[model samples]
Target: MPLQAHVVAPSRTAHVLEIIKGAILSGDLAAGSPLVETDLALQLGVSKTPVREALKTLEGTGLVVIRPYLGATVREMSYEDAAAVYDMRLLLEPEAVRRTVAAGGRLSAAERALERAREADGGVARSAANREFHRALYEGCGNPLLVASLDGLRDQTSLVSVAAWARRASWETEAAEHEEILGAAREGRADEAADLVRRHVAAFLDRLPKQDIDPAPPSP
Candidate 1:
């Protein structure tokens, strides 16, 4: 039987979407896992209607794919997919840091945001916070379009990484990279900051596991 939803609300669809997203990010819903509306509705304690809506939302987000008569399946991460996302980040995010540093002082805000992100270093929530911190930094770049693009790219990237990210030693390494970028931004050196960000993204792309997604059955 599906677990009951903790609360009933007008925004039930959005709530359901968020819960499934959390499940995926926390590795409870691994890639390629079947997502039956009935099963999900039961598990989440919501009616099938909201679950359907939520699945539709996720499909649009590239987090899941809904095939006709096939139901919904969690999207797998391929190296090609990861590379495409990294390419966008390479093209836009570095420039965002450069523009932000060129526009004004954002070092203080970056520091504060980084601190907030680190507050949950070992849990699912921490991954969400960390994504926010980086997005906040890029949002300061003063280009709304670039910020939005990078935001989407980051979300796609997270879908591939958030599951095992909390267990990697590189989490601390990434924090240090953030510090370096912050320092460069603080010194009013946009070029230096861009350089650091560029290399940081490159290094991350190089280290991702090649497995993409496992084909094993979902946990019982």
Candidate 2:
């Protein structure tokens, strides 16, 4: 008996990428779990070519690792890795906030994202909304390169955020931080916005598990 072929969308590669990335971010695909192209293709109702391409693209974003012989697996973010990612964000995000404020970028998008975050239940929904709030703020920085860089960094750090959320029921606190940051940006207080974002990211770093410090290479 022949298995029926699934219809491929015009943006098949991108579709596959989002599906796989969402699975990883939501922890449906755990860290270090093998990403078999055949299985993913079957599960996503797409062909293996798009799945293969999506894996390659995800690898570039540091979300998935592809070894020569071992194949693809979700990347495990170590404590050291998380610290470094947060450190880089501290350096970049504040500047992004400042730039957005200086340019007087429309802040309504950020406000909406904040509302979504506030309304969402804790866990993946809230975390996703939190990410959108940050993106809405920084994407207005008027620097495509910086925005692209931060987007990649955000995807890579989602695992850390999910793990942190599980350990500390701090969604309310995080929602409050986003509100304050949005208020500062809306008021055109570039310095205040910058400072708030800096503090917000730093607070998240403080919540990460200490035991995750050890770096573990993906099994090959």
The numbered model that scores best in TM-score is: 2
Off by over 4 Å in 1: 1-4, 105-109, 121-123, 163-168, 212-220
Residues 90-151 of candidate 1 have per-residue lDDT tens digits of: 98988898888888745665677788767874556656666766675678888788887887
Question: What's the alpha carbon RMSD for model 1?
Answer: 3.2
CA error at residue 34 for candidate 1, angstroms: 0.9
CA-lDDT, candidates in order: 0.75, 0.82
Q: What is the lDDT of candidate 2?
A: 0.82
lDDT string, candidate 2, 82-190, tens digits: 8988998998999998999989998888888788877876577777878888988999899999998899887766777886676667677877888899889988999
My TM-score estimates for the predictions, one after another, are 0.86, 0.89
RMSD of each: 3.2, 4.0
